[model samples]
Target: MFFSVIIPTYNRLPILKKCLTALEHQSNHNSVENYEVILVDDGSTDGTLKWLQDHQLEFPHVRWFCQTHQGPAAARNLGVQQAEGDTIIFIDSDLVVTENFLKAHATALIQASKISDRVFTYGRVINTCNFEYPTAEPYKITDFSAAYFATGNVAIARHWLIEAGLFDTQFHLYGWEDLELGVRLKKLGLTLIKCPDAVGYHWHPPFALEQLPNLIEREIQRGRMGVLFYQKHPSLEVKLMIQMTILHQVLWGILSVGGRLNERTMAGVLQWLINQGKPQLALEIARIFLNWYNVRAVYAAYREL
Candidate 1:
């Protein structure tokens, strides 16, 4: 089957160049056919569009499209519309690919198709070479569901994806959209498979300890989305467990942590609790903290941050 590797990028031309170069290697593979690289320029102010055009003459297999400053969700949907391949594989621009990455996906689909009608595949990162970048790993993959959903690097049957509907553009930012898709696909009874042989090298951003405030804000935004997700699927007990577990950990941090890091963690948790609408629940969180430490000191620091 033909393969379509869709990459959605914004203002990261250098990284995109490396990704496309990897795609070039994939196209040269003997078994792959009618393969094409769909590069969606998601309203980049950088010279991304110019570079794609210049490379158009060089890589005839590459196709380029542009949209006004819409997010990656919209850009990917556009790429799906234009893709000619039967199987669609998506990889983030700020990544490197193994030689067999695309081949492994194609292999999985062909093998799955022989036994079943539906095929959804995902890959893992063998080693992340560039951890100092923003795209570096934050969440633990081992914690991911058996459906093995991760947008960092994955492939799916084009027909199956269209049937499941594209990503929820409503998310509009860095959070939960992939989980949203995984939940939807599971509800539809699709087969999700993980391929360990195929790997992607990710370049994640290096976060400093002093950046706790900004990180807390980002988590707050993501946490809000997580609440919405749990609200929709009350049976997903893991979601509730994670929320309560984080609260529990922060409480432990207040008593056990001695340095600035522990203090920051406790402060951040309290800030998160205050923004939450449930005052009673916030009080409970505070009570949990008090269970191990001086309630008055913890309460004062909680309010200070």
Candidate 2:
């Protein structure tokens, strides 16, 4: 086999079904015969395990494994460990692949070295969901350059991934692990080609007003992880940009909240301002707007409940 597709999913059985259906369709195509699908259940509480057990209709090769709730990184690593192919393609359970998606990724990895000796492998993430967000047109192969690469849907050499140490298991959430891996691969003189030809539709339902809190929490964590990226790169321009962005978010929160600052957000705002060399100004802003995000997050959580 030339490739193995690994999908790590948690409590999203219906979405997984959609993704598998797409994968099965892809497998029927001539280019996908040499691939296998490895679906790793990340300790889903939903009846995903039962469904997988009942469905054995093989289109592309299908296999399932269950593990304790160790987060997506561990689940992916487990999938990589079980893969028998030279290359492993990682896709989310909530993504439906296009007919040419697998072929494009495989072709890019195979031909990447010819384009540039520095290019080792590549991956791409394309938005294909057509409901609310605008769907993107077919992308060319050259889109997967080193400057722009998305991790959510990526294909890489299996052994090279092992050599790169796979994903950082410390990232127990949904972000940063991809960037960390990309940075390391770049450091090793490997160029990540963004194969825009690989496209997939997001299977999750349209965004709901009720789930805003989780989004806010994820953004806060994203900001914190941005700090980690700054620490690694340590560029003054980059630092200023991140700090300013966070400050802007805080300012917006304050404006929305009628001037009450949340304690946690206030700390983030103040800390961010201090780093930007305007502590007093940042303090004044935080004193007012921090409560706004707090209230927003609170209301968002209540709505979810």
Clashes of each: 6, 8
Q: Score candidate 2 by TM-score against the native.
A: 0.70
Model 2, 248-278: lDDT tens digits are 5456665746544344445565566567766
Candidate 1 residue lDDT tens string, 1-305: 78888888888887777777766775355556768889888889999988777767777779889998777778888899999998888888887776787788777767787888666788875333353342243435533444346677888878877887987776665556677777777777878778766677765333233444454444545555554555556553535332434464465566455323343446656566556644334434443433333322323333444
Best by TM-score: 1
Q: What TM-scores do the predictions have? A: 0.72, 0.70
Off by over 4 Å in 2: 27-33, 58-60, 115-149, 226-305
The whole-model C-alpha lDDT of candidate 1 against the native structure comes to 0.66
Taken over the whole model, the C-alpha lDDT of each candidate is 0.66, 0.64
